[model samples]
Target: MELLRTKNLTKVYQQGKHTVNALTDCNIRIEQGEFVAIMGPSGSGKSTLLHLLGALDKPTDGNVWFDGKDMYSLPAEELARIRRQEIGQVFQDFQLIPIMSAYENIITPVLLDKQKPEKEYVEALAERLQIKDRLHHFPAELSGGQKQRVAIARALLMQPKLILADEPTGNLDKESAEEVLNLFIQAVKEAGSTLIMITHDAAIAERAGRVLRIDNGRVTG
Candidate 1:
């Protein structure tokens, strides 16, 4: 089943006097339980595409469908709710709350929605990702890999239909990066979550089931 579909997606920003198109009529579709990597160079539209698909932005001209529902058609509040409840985001900066413990950060989404985290599932996931012992620690106290693991844990907490990650391992060492990427791939597979990741690393992109090459606001190859 198609988890997400975008038709003629376009994003534009005014850079002083010139209007730059970050993404230009780019059509894409991601299937359920599929791991996809959107790869491009620094100026390409990979990040823009990810943001569009994740419901974080309004496209200049296009529509995003999430599980057969038009995401853009919903009210702002409803869209935000869907992003939190049905879509998980793993950001490049880790985005963990500085004051909260790792456990608190991971389950923050549940709290925001007035729902409880599934304790058993979370515990098992943390153990598998090798971050069980670091739960009480804050992001400031964790190693790079450990911090990313905590971020991943938070993304997995919702059992989301789609996981949208933007350079998830960009800040970690090679070994740590591999570990995080592997964990992401495994979690998406095991949890039946669809994944759409943006990366500039070819090695990391190769791990995805499908790799799309984007450049100059379009798929070049």
Candidate 2:
């Protein structure tokens, strides 16, 4: 089943007097349980595509359909609801609250939505991510790997339809990166969720089932 798709997706940015095409005539689709990796250089619009795919930003001209529903056509509130409930995002810089503990951080989204966090499920997920013991610790206390693991746990807490990870392992050391990557992949598969990741490392990208190479605002592979 097609979980997410973009048709003729385009993004243009105007800087002062210059018009820049961040993404142009791009088209892509992701299957329901597939893992996809997006690779590109710094200015290749990789992040722009992710922002659009996740509905964080609007496309200049195109349509983004998630589960056959047009994302951009929805009202702002409805779109925000879907983004909160159906989509999960992980970033290179762990976006955790400085004052919140690991467990608190993991359940932040649920709390924001005015819902109660499922304790059992959250505990199990933390165990799976191997950060159960550190749940009480703050982000500043945990190592890079530990922090990323907590981020992964948070992303998977809601069992979102799609998990968007941007340079998830970019800050970790080799061993930690490998460990987190393995846990992340396994957890996503076990949850039967789709994953789309952006990385500049080919070796890391290889872990994905399919890779889409973006260059000059277009998919080259």
Candidate 3:
């Protein structure tokens, strides 16, 4: 089934006197449980598109439909709720709380929702991601790969419908990158979640079931 759709999606930014068109008249559809990789060069509006799709920012023009609902048309509180409970995001920078242990970081979303953490599920997820041993370590104490794994676990903790990953392996070494990516793909597939990942590397893109290329803020494929 179609899980996400965008029509004439556009975003504009103003930097001083310059009007920057980050994205323009883009339309795309993503299906449930499909893995999609988006490729683009620097300043190509790849991240901008991801942010818009994930409901992190509002588009200047156009509409986004997630799960058959017009996301941009929803009220602010409803949109925020959908963003929190339905979409999961993983960043290249390993956006974990430095003060929290790896385990705490993984369960942060649940805590944010004011729900009790499901310890069994969290531990199983950590084990699957191979981060169970590192759970007690804080972000500062974990290696780059470990940190990213923790981030992935956090993203999957809520069993979100969509997972948005932005250059998730950019900070890791070749071996670690492959490891993390494999684990990530397996975890997402097992959860039957749709994945939209941004990757600059062609090799990485090839791993996805489908690839979408964006250039000058437009989706080329």
Candidate 4:
């Protein structure tokens, strides 16, 4: 089933007198439970598209549909609720709180919404990601791969309908990157969540069932 769709999506940025078209008339349909990879060079509007699709930003012209509801048409609080409950995001920088232990970071989202954490599931997820041993450790204390694993665990904890990954492996070494990717794929599958990832590596992109290429603010492939 189609979980998300965009129609005539466009984003334009104005810098003084110059107008930059970050994205133009882009249309995409993402179904539930599919792994999608978006590839593009730097400043190709790949991130722009991701942000719009994930509801992190609004499009200048067009509409976004999530499970048949017009996402952009919703009120601000409703959109924020969707972001917190329906979508999970993993960034290249790990984005874990340095002051919090791994365990605290993973459950932060749930706590934010005043919901009880599923302790068993969280523990199981941590084990699956091989971060069980590092729960008490802070982000600064863990290695790069461990930090990413923690981030993945956090994203999966919510069992979100969709997970958005932006350069998830950009900070890791070759071996660590591969390990993180493998863990991510398995975790998302176990959670029954859809994935849309942005990657510059062709090899990494190959792992996704569908590959969308973007350049000059348009889908090229």
**All-Cα superposition RMSD per candidate:** 1.2, 0.7, 0.6, 0.8
Q: State the lDDT at 17 in candidate 2.
A: 100
How much is the lDDT of residue 181 in candidate 4? 99
Quote the lDDT for 90 in model 1.
Answer: 92
Q: lDDT: which candidate is best? A: 3
For candidate 2, the per-residue lDDT at 106 reads 99
Tens digit per residue, CA lDDT, model 1, 125-208 = 898788999999999999998999999889988889999999999989899899888887887788889988888898988888
**How does model 4 fare in lDDT?**
0.93
Q: Residue 158's C-alpha lDDT in candidate 3?
A: 91
**What does candidate 3's lDDT look like per residue over 63-120, in tens digits?**
9999999999999999988888899999999999999999999999999888999899
In model 1, what lDDT does residue 220 have? 59
**Residue 201 in model 2: lDDT:** 84
- Kindly report which residue stretches of model 4 are placed more than 4 angstroms away from their true locations once superposed: none
Evaluate model 2: give its lDDT. Answer: 0.94
Candidate 1 residue runs with Cα over 4 Å from true position: none
Indicate the worst ten consecutive residues by lDDT in candidate 1.
Answer: 182-191
Estimate the TM-score of every prediction. 0.96, 0.98, 0.99, 0.98
User: For model 4, how does the per-residue alpha-carbon lDDT over 66-93 read when each residue is reduced to its tens digit?
Assistant: 9888999999999998899989999999
Q: Candidate 1 or 2, higher TM-score?
A: 2
**Stretches of candidate 2 exceeding 4 Å from the true structure:** none
Best by TM-score: 3
lDDT of 4 at 108: 93
RMSD of 1: 1.2
